[model samples]
Target: MNESSDLQRFQELIEASAERELTEVETAFIGRMGFRSEQCRQWLEADAEVVAAAVEQDPLRTVPAATTLDWARVDAGLRRAGALPDSRAQSRNAWPLLPAAAALLLCIGVINAILRDGLSTTPQAPPEVVAEVLDLPEGDGSLILHEGDDEGVLMIILSNG
Candidate 1:
Protein backbone atom coordinates (compact mmCIF):
# COMPACT_ATOMS: atom_id res chain seq x y z
CA MET A 1 0.00 0.00 0.00
CA ASN A 2 1.07 3.59 -0.63
CA GLU A 3 2.17 5.90 2.22
CA SER A 4 -0.98 8.06 1.78
CA SER A 5 -3.29 4.97 2.01
CA ASP A 6 -1.47 3.88 5.18
CA LEU A 7 -1.87 7.35 6.73
CA GLN A 8 -5.59 7.41 5.70
CA ARG A 9 -6.20 4.05 7.39
CA PHE A 10 -4.41 5.27 10.51
CA GLN A 11 -6.64 8.40 10.68
CA GLU A 12 -9.80 6.26 10.19
CA LEU A 13 -8.74 3.96 13.02
CA ILE A 14 -8.08 6.91 15.37
CA GLU A 15 -11.53 8.44 14.61
CA ALA A 16 -13.26 5.05 15.03
CA SER A 17 -11.49 4.45 18.38
CA ALA A 18 -13.07 7.67 19.71
CA GLU A 19 -16.63 6.34 18.95
CA ARG A 20 -16.18 2.57 19.75
CA GLU A 21 -13.63 -0.10 20.73
CA LEU A 22 -11.31 -1.10 17.82
CA THR A 23 -10.95 -4.68 16.55
CA GLU A 24 -7.64 -6.55 17.14
CA VAL A 25 -6.59 -6.02 13.48
CA GLU A 26 -7.37 -2.27 13.68
CA THR A 27 -5.45 -2.00 17.02
CA ALA A 28 -2.46 -3.80 15.51
CA PHE A 29 -2.56 -1.43 12.50
CA ILE A 30 -2.55 1.60 14.86
CA GLY A 31 0.43 0.15 16.83
CA ARG A 32 2.43 -0.53 13.66
CA MET A 33 1.80 3.01 12.34
CA GLY A 34 2.63 4.56 15.75
CA PHE A 35 6.02 2.80 15.67
CA ARG A 36 6.70 3.74 12.05
CA SER A 37 5.78 7.46 12.05
CA GLU A 38 6.54 10.18 14.65
CA GLN A 39 3.15 11.93 13.89
CA CYS A 40 1.23 8.69 14.56
CA ARG A 41 3.11 8.28 17.84
CA GLN A 42 2.11 11.79 18.94
CA TRP A 43 -1.61 11.11 18.08
CA LEU A 44 -1.47 7.83 20.06
CA GLU A 45 0.01 9.63 23.09
CA ALA A 46 -2.75 12.36 22.98
CA ASP A 47 -5.50 9.72 22.76
CA ALA A 48 -3.97 7.85 25.72
CA GLU A 49 -3.86 11.03 27.85
CA VAL A 50 -7.55 11.80 27.09
CA VAL A 51 -8.62 8.25 28.04
CA ALA A 52 -6.57 8.36 31.26
CA ALA A 53 -8.10 11.70 32.34
CA ALA A 54 -11.69 10.45 31.67
CA VAL A 55 -11.07 7.29 33.66
CA GLU A 56 -9.56 9.18 36.64
CA GLN A 57 -12.39 11.77 36.99
CA ASP A 58 -15.36 11.17 39.31
CA PRO A 59 -18.75 11.06 37.52
CA LEU A 60 -20.76 12.74 40.31
CA ARG A 61 -19.72 15.00 43.21
CA THR A 62 -20.85 14.26 46.81
CA VAL A 63 -23.60 16.69 48.03
CA PRO A 64 -23.52 18.57 51.34
CA ALA A 65 -25.94 17.57 54.18
CA ALA A 66 -29.16 19.52 54.87
CA THR A 67 -29.13 21.93 57.90
CA THR A 68 -31.96 23.37 60.07
CA LEU A 69 -32.57 27.18 60.35
CA ASP A 70 -32.96 29.07 63.66
CA TRP A 71 -35.88 31.51 63.28
CA ALA A 72 -35.16 33.35 66.58
CA ARG A 73 -31.81 34.55 65.28
CA VAL A 74 -33.43 35.87 62.10
CA ASP A 75 -36.07 37.75 64.10
CA ALA A 76 -33.43 39.29 66.40
CA GLY A 77 -31.39 40.45 63.42
CA LEU A 78 -34.45 42.05 61.78
CA ARG A 79 -35.32 43.90 65.01
CA ARG A 80 -31.76 45.16 65.39
CA ALA A 81 -31.86 46.48 61.80
CA GLY A 82 -35.13 48.37 62.58
CA ALA A 83 -37.03 46.35 60.02
CA LEU A 84 -39.45 45.05 62.69
CA PRO A 85 -41.34 46.90 65.45
CA ASP A 86 -40.45 46.14 69.08
CA SER A 87 -43.11 44.12 70.91
CA ARG A 88 -42.46 45.84 74.28
CA ALA A 89 -43.14 49.41 72.98
CA GLN A 90 -46.67 50.77 72.50
CA SER A 91 -47.77 51.97 69.04
CA ARG A 92 -48.60 55.67 68.49
CA ASN A 93 -52.09 56.86 69.59
CA ALA A 94 -52.43 59.40 66.73
CA TRP A 95 -54.47 56.93 64.67
CA PRO A 96 -57.43 57.30 67.07
CA LEU A 97 -57.52 61.13 66.63
CA LEU A 98 -57.63 60.97 62.84
CA PRO A 99 -61.38 60.35 62.77
CA ALA A 100 -62.09 63.24 65.13
CA ALA A 101 -60.04 65.66 63.00
CA ALA A 102 -61.82 64.46 59.86
CA ALA A 103 -65.22 65.02 61.53
CA LEU A 104 -64.26 68.58 62.58
CA LEU A 105 -63.14 69.40 59.02
CA LEU A 106 -66.40 68.05 57.65
CA CYS A 107 -68.45 70.19 60.09
CA ILE A 108 -66.46 73.30 59.14
CA GLY A 109 -67.03 72.57 55.43
CA VAL A 110 -70.78 72.11 56.03
CA ILE A 111 -71.04 75.39 57.97
CA ASN A 112 -69.06 77.16 55.26
CA ALA A 113 -71.41 75.76 52.62
CA ILE A 114 -74.47 76.95 54.60
CA LEU A 115 -73.05 80.45 55.02
CA ARG A 116 -72.08 80.62 51.35
CA ASP A 117 -75.59 79.54 50.32
CA GLY A 118 -77.16 82.11 52.68
CA LEU A 119 -75.06 84.96 51.20
CA SER A 120 -75.21 83.77 47.58
CA THR A 121 -78.84 84.89 47.03
CA THR A 122 -78.98 88.01 44.83
CA PRO A 123 -80.80 90.92 46.59
CA GLN A 124 -84.34 91.45 45.32
CA ALA A 125 -84.25 94.03 42.55
CA PRO A 126 -85.54 96.82 44.82
CA PRO A 127 -89.17 95.67 44.22
CA GLU A 128 -89.10 97.22 40.71
CA VAL A 129 -90.80 100.53 41.76
CA VAL A 130 -93.75 99.92 39.35
CA ALA A 131 -95.79 102.86 40.75
CA GLU A 132 -96.25 104.98 43.83
CA VAL A 133 -99.39 106.32 45.40
CA LEU A 134 -99.56 109.00 48.06
CA ASP A 135 -102.64 109.83 50.11
CA LEU A 136 -102.44 112.60 52.67
CA PRO A 137 -104.99 113.11 55.37
CA GLU A 138 -106.08 116.67 56.25
CA GLY A 139 -104.20 116.52 59.58
CA ASP A 140 -101.12 114.80 61.15
CA GLY A 141 -100.47 111.22 59.86
CA SER A 142 -97.60 108.86 58.89
CA LEU A 143 -97.10 105.88 56.45
CA ILE A 144 -94.34 103.27 56.03
CA LEU A 145 -94.17 100.75 53.14
CA HIS A 146 -91.54 98.02 52.57
CA GLU A 147 -91.05 94.63 50.84
CA GLY A 148 -91.12 91.45 53.02
CA ASP A 149 -88.83 88.36 52.59
CA ASP A 150 -91.50 86.62 50.46
CA GLU A 151 -91.59 87.60 46.78
CA GLY A 152 -94.22 90.24 45.84
CA VAL A 153 -95.29 90.62 49.48
CA LEU A 154 -95.51 94.20 50.82
CA MET A 155 -95.98 95.53 54.37
CA ILE A 156 -97.58 98.93 55.13
CA ILE A 157 -98.26 100.67 58.43
CA LEU A 158 -100.32 103.83 59.03
CA SER A 159 -100.75 105.65 62.38
CA ASN A 160 -102.64 108.81 63.18
CA GLY A 161 -103.45 110.43 66.57
Candidate 2:
Protein backbone atom coordinates (compact mmCIF):
# COMPACT_ATOMS: atom_id res chain seq x y z
CA MET A 1 0.00 0.00 0.00
CA ASN A 2 1.04 3.59 -0.52
CA GLU A 3 2.04 5.84 2.43
CA SER A 4 -1.36 7.58 2.48
CA SER A 5 -3.17 4.24 2.58
CA ASP A 6 -0.87 3.09 5.38
CA LEU A 7 -1.56 6.31 7.36
CA GLN A 8 -5.34 5.90 6.86
CA ARG A 9 -5.07 2.31 8.06
CA PHE A 10 -3.01 3.48 11.08
CA GLN A 11 -5.74 6.05 12.01
CA GLU A 12 -8.45 3.41 11.64
CA LEU A 13 -6.50 1.03 13.88
CA ILE A 14 -6.06 3.79 16.52
CA GLU A 15 -9.83 4.43 16.39
CA ALA A 16 -10.54 0.69 16.71
CA SER A 17 -8.11 0.46 19.70
CA ALA A 18 -9.84 3.47 21.33
CA GLU A 19 -13.13 1.60 20.98
CA ARG A 20 -11.43 -1.44 22.74
CA GLU A 21 -12.29 -3.76 19.82
CA LEU A 22 -8.81 -4.16 18.19
CA THR A 23 -8.13 -7.85 17.51
CA GLU A 24 -4.87 -9.56 18.58
CA VAL A 25 -3.76 -9.59 14.93
CA GLU A 26 -4.26 -5.80 14.68
CA THR A 27 -2.37 -5.30 17.98
CA ALA A 28 0.52 -7.50 16.77
CA PHE A 29 0.59 -5.67 13.47
CA ILE A 30 0.72 -2.22 15.17
CA GLY A 31 3.41 -3.46 17.60
CA ARG A 32 5.52 -4.68 14.75
CA MET A 33 5.14 -1.37 12.88
CA GLY A 34 6.02 0.67 16.06
CA PHE A 35 9.10 -1.51 16.66
CA ARG A 36 10.35 -0.77 13.17
CA SER A 37 10.05 3.04 13.43
CA GLU A 38 13.18 5.14 14.06
CA GLN A 39 11.07 7.73 16.01
CA CYS A 40 9.90 4.99 18.38
CA ARG A 41 13.50 3.94 19.03
CA GLN A 42 14.53 7.56 19.69
CA TRP A 43 11.59 7.99 22.14
CA LEU A 44 12.61 4.82 23.98
CA GLU A 45 16.22 6.10 24.19
CA ALA A 46 15.23 9.67 25.43
CA ASP A 47 16.80 10.94 28.68
CA ALA A 48 14.85 10.01 31.83
CA GLU A 49 14.89 13.62 33.15
CA VAL A 50 13.57 15.06 29.85
CA VAL A 51 10.77 12.49 29.73
CA ALA A 52 9.92 13.19 33.41
CA ALA A 53 9.88 17.01 32.87
CA ALA A 54 7.63 16.66 29.83
CA VAL A 55 5.24 14.14 31.42
CA GLU A 56 4.98 15.70 34.89
CA GLN A 57 3.97 19.15 33.54
CA ASP A 58 0.16 19.40 33.47
CA PRO A 59 -0.93 22.41 31.33
CA LEU A 60 -4.32 22.62 33.04
CA ARG A 61 -2.73 23.19 36.48
CA THR A 62 0.57 24.83 35.49
CA VAL A 63 -0.94 27.38 33.08
CA PRO A 64 -3.09 29.00 35.75
CA ALA A 65 -0.26 28.87 38.32
CA ALA A 66 2.18 30.54 35.92
CA THR A 67 -0.22 33.19 34.57
CA THR A 68 -2.12 34.42 37.66
CA LEU A 69 -2.73 38.22 37.73
CA ASP A 70 -1.20 40.23 40.61
CA TRP A 71 -4.12 42.13 42.20
CA ALA A 72 -1.93 44.73 44.01
CA ARG A 73 -0.21 45.72 40.78
CA VAL A 74 -3.57 46.00 39.09
CA ASP A 75 -4.91 48.26 41.87
CA ALA A 76 -1.85 50.53 41.72
CA GLY A 77 -2.23 50.83 37.96
CA LEU A 78 -5.89 51.73 38.40
CA ARG A 79 -4.96 54.46 40.88
CA ARG A 80 -2.29 55.87 38.59
CA ALA A 81 -4.75 55.92 35.70
CA GLY A 82 -7.18 58.06 37.79
CA ALA A 83 -9.81 55.35 38.08
CA LEU A 84 -9.65 55.60 41.90
CA PRO A 85 -7.86 57.63 44.59
CA ASP A 86 -5.52 55.91 47.01
CA SER A 87 -5.73 56.49 50.77
CA ARG A 88 -2.76 58.89 50.68
CA ALA A 89 -4.41 61.17 48.10
CA GLN A 90 -7.71 61.08 49.98
CA SER A 91 -5.96 62.24 53.17
CA ARG A 92 -4.16 65.01 51.27
CA ASN A 93 -7.43 66.20 49.73
CA ALA A 94 -8.91 66.66 53.22
CA TRP A 95 -6.48 69.57 53.95
CA PRO A 96 -8.90 72.29 52.74
CA LEU A 97 -10.09 72.85 56.36
CA LEU A 98 -6.76 74.46 57.32
CA PRO A 99 -7.81 77.94 56.13
CA ALA A 100 -10.96 77.91 58.30
CA ALA A 101 -8.89 76.89 61.35
CA ALA A 102 -6.43 79.70 60.68
CA ALA A 103 -9.32 82.19 60.33
CA LEU A 104 -10.70 81.15 63.70
CA LEU A 105 -7.29 81.64 65.33
CA LEU A 106 -6.97 85.05 63.70
CA CYS A 107 -10.40 86.13 65.04
CA ILE A 108 -9.43 84.97 68.54
CA GLY A 109 -6.15 86.89 68.35
CA VAL A 110 -7.92 90.06 67.12
CA ILE A 111 -10.46 89.91 69.98
CA ASN A 112 -7.63 89.43 72.49
CA ALA A 113 -5.70 92.38 71.07
CA ILE A 114 -8.80 94.63 71.17
CA LEU A 115 -9.58 93.75 74.82
CA ARG A 116 -5.94 94.33 75.88
CA ASP A 117 -5.75 97.73 74.19
CA GLY A 118 -9.14 98.74 75.61
CA LEU A 119 -8.11 97.81 79.18
CA SER A 120 -4.67 99.46 79.03
CA THR A 121 -5.93 102.85 77.71
CA THR A 122 -8.25 103.54 80.67
CA PRO A 123 -7.15 104.86 84.18
CA GLN A 124 -8.31 103.00 87.33
CA ALA A 125 -9.18 105.33 90.20
CA PRO A 126 -8.58 104.55 93.90
CA PRO A 127 -11.56 103.66 96.13
CA GLU A 128 -13.03 106.37 98.44
CA VAL A 129 -11.30 106.54 101.89
CA VAL A 130 -13.46 106.49 105.04
CA ALA A 131 -12.14 106.91 108.70
CA GLU A 132 -13.48 105.71 112.02
CA VAL A 133 -12.22 106.88 115.50
CA LEU A 134 -12.38 104.56 118.51
CA ASP A 135 -11.25 104.84 122.20
CA LEU A 136 -9.43 102.09 124.13
CA PRO A 137 -10.89 100.75 127.39
CA GLU A 138 -7.59 101.32 129.36
CA GLY A 139 -6.74 104.93 130.29
CA ASP A 140 -3.03 106.22 129.72
CA GLY A 141 -2.44 104.88 126.14
CA SER A 142 -2.00 107.11 123.10
CA LEU A 143 -3.85 106.90 119.71
CA ILE A 144 -1.67 106.65 116.57
CA LEU A 145 -2.65 107.44 112.96
CA HIS A 146 -0.87 105.80 109.96
CA GLU A 147 -1.30 106.52 106.24
CA GLY A 148 -2.10 103.71 103.80
CA ASP A 149 -1.65 103.48 100.03
CA ASP A 150 0.00 105.98 97.66
CA GLU A 151 -3.05 108.28 98.12
CA GLY A 152 -2.08 108.83 101.82
CA VAL A 153 -5.41 107.75 103.31
CA LEU A 154 -5.32 107.69 107.12
CA MET A 155 -5.93 104.49 109.14
CA ILE A 156 -6.69 105.24 112.90
CA ILE A 157 -5.50 102.97 115.70
CA LEU A 158 -6.33 103.57 119.46
CA SER A 159 -4.26 102.41 122.51
CA ASN A 160 -4.65 102.81 126.28
CA GLY A 161 -3.89 106.49 127.26
Candidate 3:
Protein backbone atom coordinates (compact mmCIF):
# COMPACT_ATOMS: atom_id res chain seq x y z
CA MET A 1 0.00 0.00 0.00
CA ASN A 2 1.05 3.65 -0.64
CA GLU A 3 1.55 6.28 2.06
CA SER A 4 -2.10 7.53 1.99
CA SER A 5 -3.51 3.98 2.26
CA ASP A 6 -1.06 3.19 5.04
CA LEU A 7 -2.22 6.34 6.90
CA GLN A 8 -5.91 5.46 6.35
CA ARG A 9 -5.43 1.91 7.64
CA PHE A 10 -3.53 3.25 10.65
CA GLN A 11 -6.35 5.71 11.38
CA GLU A 12 -8.98 2.98 11.08
CA LEU A 13 -7.02 0.68 13.44
CA ILE A 14 -6.68 3.52 16.01
CA GLU A 15 -10.42 4.28 15.88
CA ALA A 16 -11.24 0.55 16.17
CA SER A 17 -8.94 0.23 19.21
CA ALA A 18 -11.14 2.68 21.11
CA GLU A 19 -14.14 0.29 20.82
CA ARG A 20 -12.43 -3.14 20.93
CA GLU A 21 -9.08 -4.83 21.55
CA LEU A 22 -6.66 -4.52 18.58
CA THR A 23 -5.35 -7.79 17.13
CA GLU A 24 -1.63 -8.65 17.45
CA VAL A 25 -1.01 -7.69 13.78
CA GLU A 26 -2.88 -4.36 14.20
CA THR A 27 -0.97 -3.65 17.45
CA ALA A 28 2.38 -4.41 15.70
CA PHE A 29 1.42 -2.06 12.85
CA ILE A 30 0.57 0.71 15.32
CA GLY A 31 3.86 0.21 17.18
CA ARG A 32 5.88 0.27 13.95
CA MET A 33 4.10 3.45 12.77
CA GLY A 34 4.64 5.08 16.17
CA PHE A 35 8.37 4.48 15.87
CA ARG A 36 8.48 6.23 12.45
CA SER A 37 6.10 9.15 13.10
CA GLU A 38 6.51 11.77 15.88
CA GLN A 39 2.72 12.47 16.16
CA CYS A 40 1.89 8.76 16.35
CA ARG A 41 4.63 8.28 18.99
CA GLN A 42 3.12 11.08 21.15
CA TRP A 43 -0.41 9.63 20.83
CA LEU A 44 0.85 6.17 21.79
CA GLU A 45 2.70 7.56 24.84
CA ALA A 46 -0.39 9.49 25.98
CA ASP A 47 -2.57 6.35 25.67
CA ALA A 48 0.00 4.30 27.63
CA GLU A 49 0.01 6.86 30.45
CA VAL A 50 -3.81 6.86 30.57
CA VAL A 51 -3.96 3.05 30.80
CA ALA A 52 -1.20 2.94 33.46
CA ALA A 53 -3.01 5.52 35.61
CA ALA A 54 -6.31 3.65 35.30
CA VAL A 55 -4.80 0.31 36.36
CA GLU A 56 -2.74 1.71 39.24
CA GLN A 57 -4.13 1.15 42.78
CA ASP A 58 -5.32 4.28 44.60
CA PRO A 59 -3.80 4.76 48.13
CA LEU A 60 -6.92 6.56 49.47
CA ARG A 61 -9.33 3.83 48.32
CA THR A 62 -8.63 1.49 51.30
CA VAL A 63 -10.48 2.74 54.40
CA PRO A 64 -8.90 2.58 57.87
CA ALA A 65 -10.76 0.72 60.67
CA ALA A 66 -12.91 2.85 62.99
CA THR A 67 -11.45 3.74 66.39
CA THR A 68 -13.28 2.52 69.52
CA LEU A 69 -14.86 5.19 71.79
CA ASP A 70 -15.24 5.36 75.61
CA TRP A 71 -18.78 6.71 76.06
CA ALA A 72 -18.32 7.31 79.84
CA ARG A 73 -15.32 9.55 79.21
CA VAL A 74 -17.21 11.43 76.47
CA ASP A 75 -20.13 12.07 78.81
CA ALA A 76 -17.81 13.27 81.59
CA GLY A 77 -16.10 15.71 79.23
CA LEU A 78 -19.41 17.08 78.00
CA ARG A 79 -20.63 17.61 81.57
CA ARG A 80 -17.38 19.40 82.54
CA ALA A 81 -17.72 21.71 79.54
CA GLY A 82 -21.33 22.55 80.55
CA ALA A 83 -22.59 21.17 77.21
CA LEU A 84 -24.73 18.62 79.14
CA PRO A 85 -26.79 19.09 82.27
CA ASP A 86 -25.82 17.39 85.57
CA SER A 87 -27.25 13.87 85.96
CA ARG A 88 -28.57 14.56 89.48
CA ALA A 89 -30.16 17.90 88.46
CA GLN A 90 -31.73 16.27 85.37
CA SER A 91 -33.33 13.59 87.53
CA ARG A 92 -34.54 16.09 90.15
CA ASN A 93 -36.30 18.30 87.55
CA ALA A 94 -39.97 17.15 87.63
CA TRP A 95 -40.79 18.76 84.25
CA PRO A 96 -41.71 15.36 82.81
CA LEU A 97 -44.68 15.09 85.30
CA LEU A 98 -46.30 18.28 83.89
CA PRO A 99 -47.92 16.40 81.00
CA ALA A 100 -49.41 13.79 83.38
CA ALA A 101 -50.68 16.52 85.71
CA ALA A 102 -52.33 18.38 82.80
CA ALA A 103 -53.97 15.17 81.63
CA LEU A 104 -55.34 14.49 85.14
CA LEU A 105 -56.74 18.04 85.38
CA LEU A 106 -58.44 17.63 81.94
CA CYS A 107 -60.07 14.38 83.11
CA ILE A 108 -61.33 16.01 86.33
CA GLY A 109 -62.81 18.97 84.37
CA VAL A 110 -64.61 16.62 81.96
CA ILE A 111 -66.07 14.60 84.84
CA ASN A 112 -67.19 17.79 86.64
CA ALA A 113 -68.96 19.06 83.48
CA ILE A 114 -70.69 15.73 83.01
CA LEU A 115 -71.92 15.63 86.60
CA ARG A 116 -73.12 19.28 86.45
CA ASP A 117 -75.07 19.05 83.17
CA GLY A 118 -75.54 15.46 82.03
CA LEU A 119 -76.92 13.14 84.79
CA SER A 120 -78.19 15.44 87.60
CA THR A 121 -81.40 16.53 85.76
CA THR A 122 -84.62 14.50 85.58
CA PRO A 123 -85.12 12.37 82.39
CA GLN A 124 -87.78 13.47 79.81
CA ALA A 125 -90.37 11.21 78.16
CA PRO A 126 -89.67 10.08 74.60
CA PRO A 127 -91.89 11.26 71.68
CA GLU A 128 -94.41 8.72 70.37
CA VAL A 129 -93.81 7.01 66.98
CA VAL A 130 -96.58 5.80 64.58
CA ALA A 131 -95.95 2.35 63.10
CA GLU A 132 -96.98 1.57 59.48
CA VAL A 133 -97.24 -1.75 57.68
CA LEU A 134 -95.90 -1.84 54.09
CA ASP A 135 -97.60 -4.03 51.44
CA LEU A 136 -94.80 -5.66 49.43
CA PRO A 137 -94.94 -7.78 46.23
CA GLU A 138 -95.18 -11.54 46.70
CA GLY A 139 -91.66 -13.01 46.31
CA ASP A 140 -88.78 -14.30 48.42
CA GLY A 141 -88.78 -11.89 51.40
CA SER A 142 -86.19 -11.03 54.09
CA LEU A 143 -86.48 -8.83 57.24
CA ILE A 144 -83.35 -7.24 58.72
CA LEU A 145 -83.41 -5.51 62.15
CA HIS A 146 -80.48 -3.45 63.51
CA GLU A 147 -79.79 -0.88 66.24
CA GLY A 148 -80.01 2.80 65.21
CA ASP A 149 -77.45 5.61 65.75
CA ASP A 150 -78.42 5.92 69.48
CA GLU A 151 -77.35 2.32 70.24
CA GLY A 152 -80.00 0.87 72.62
CA VAL A 153 -82.24 4.00 72.37
CA LEU A 154 -83.63 3.28 68.86
CA MET A 155 -83.97 0.41 66.34
CA ILE A 156 -84.32 0.17 62.53
CA ILE A 157 -86.00 -2.52 60.42
CA LEU A 158 -85.57 -3.21 56.69
CA SER A 159 -87.60 -5.66 54.55
CA ASN A 160 -86.69 -6.84 51.04
CA GLY A 161 -89.33 -8.69 48.93
- Candidate 1 residue runs with Cα over 4 Å from true position: 42-161
Q: Give all candidates' CA lDDT scores.
A: 0.58, 0.53, 0.56
Clashing pairs in 2: 139-161, 140-160, 140-161, 141-160, 141-161
List, residue by residue over 57-136, the lDDT tens digit for candidate 2: 76654455422357667877999899878866775455335533543454455445544543233454433333322343
What is the Å distance of residue 127 in model 2 from its true position? 99
CA displacement after TM-score superposition, residue 107 of candidate 3 (Å):
97
Clashes of each: 0, 5, 0
Per-residue lDDT of 1-161 in model 1, one digit per residue for the tens? 77678878898998999999999999999989989977667755876877777766755344344444556677768888888876434223342255435544544554455445532276543232211223554322333343334455343433342
> 1-161 in candidate 3: lDDT tens per residue?
76566667777898899999999999999878878866666655767877777766665466564444666678779998999888856744653355335544544554455445543245533322322223333331322222222223232233333
Which candidate's TM-score is highest?
1
Report the number of backbone clashes for model 3.
0
What is candidate 1's CA lDDT for residue 61? 45
Error of 3 at 130 (Å): 99
